[model samples]
Target: MLLRIFHVSAASLFWYTAWYDQNFINVPFPNKEYAQYALKGRVTFLTFWCLVLQTIYFTLSVLNDYIGTNADQSKHASLLRTIKDTLFVLAFPVALYVTSAFWGIYAVDKDLIFPDWLAKLVPSWVNHTMHTFILLFIALELVITYRRYPSRAVGYSIVILFNLMYTIWFHCIYYQTGVWVYPIYSVLNWPARVGLQLASTSTALGFYVLGEKLNDFVWTKVHNKMVKSN
Candidate 1:
């Protein structure tokens, strides 16, 4: 219960900071470009989904407690368990990837990852809120909870769909404004653009598989301990 609340709170806080900075503190007034604010990019999309996933889990927890299920592993066909499994399976990799991509790019050239002008407005703490601590929060959740992963087909399908959607969205944005969302995309020629996109998609797909394997490993140990206790 406490951990659920903490997860919900942390996700909520990240949303607050993201919106407050964009809608309130941004210079020259609030950002009016809806595409710029759209949940198309990784950071915003993942953060948004984290809040959603946490909220759903929190509500499910409350519902279970109210109905006196109390975390029973065998109840209502494990509906809550299934939902949480899918949620974490999808969310874990994305959150980890977001943090890794940010720092990885930041290390190479901060400008490529984050445009300097917007980057200057954001403090290190805020940057970590979206990147670093988000990963930590998900990690803590993983350490405490055992998630039963769905099949690899389901997991890989979702990842592919998500990456495709975002790629299309960026293309649409470019079509609409004759400018790419990230400056890096604008400089790339057709072949280079395709190559970069493929590399990124492959990286995300790798993370999806990694998350599944990690979940299986963790929960296998947890289940073993539970069996031994019995």
Candidate 2:
């Protein structure tokens, strides 16, 4: 109960702040006030969506625990947890991978990607909010609660559909604005773009599998410990 409430509050606060900064304060593009990036940004946007998903997830969980009937609670809880896990599995890798990729590119040619000018506009805390802390929050959720994953067919299908939709979104943004939202995308050839997106999709799927395995491992260990104690 406490965990769910905390999760909801924390996620909501962080995302609201981020949305404000991204839309109002940061304004990455100069002379383009009111030209909010919206859907055409980095993986951070995806992370934001995951945060929104979790806020609802935990909110529902709280209701399920306190307000829902027992039998109904289990059904609702299981479905909500599976959805939360799927969102995390997708958000975690993308956040880490994007952050790592940015640093790598920054180290070599900072101007190419996260140039110093832009970095100043996007402060460290904001960066961590969108990138680093996202993974941490998701990890905390997993540790505090273990939920059984749905079958791979259902889980992977939902995840893959999201990735595919995002891919289409980025392409549409490029067509509309003639600007690649991420600098790294600009450097890639068509084949490379295809390859990278495919790799990202595969990596996200791999993380989902990892989450399932981790859930099983941790819960099994916990069950054994409980049994031994008894």
Q: Report every candidate's CA lDDT.
A: 0.65, 0.62
User: TM-score of every model?
Assistant: 0.77, 0.74
Kindly report which residue stretches of model 2 are placed more than 4 angstroms away from their true locations once superposed.
22-24, 30-113, 221-230
Question: Which pairs clash in model 1?
Answer: none
lDDT of candidate 1 at residue 89, scale 0 to 100: 69
Model 2 clashing-pair count:
0
Q: For candidate 2, write residues 114-180 as lDDT tens digits.
A: 5677777777776666556656666666666655566889878877887888788767767767776
- In terms of lDDT, which candidate is strongest? 1
User: Any residue pairs clashing in model 2, and if so which?
Assistant: none
TM-score of 1: 0.77
- At residue 69, give the lDDT of candidate 2: 26
Q: What 10-residue stretch in candidate 2 is worst by lDDT? A: 67-76
lDDT accuracy of residue 199 in candidate 1: 92
* Tens-digit lDDT string for candidate 1 (1-230): 67557655665666576566556444321223533544423333444454445445445544544453434242254665566556676677777777897889889987776667867777767677767776787777676666666678888887888778778876875676676656677688999999998998888889888877776676786667656766
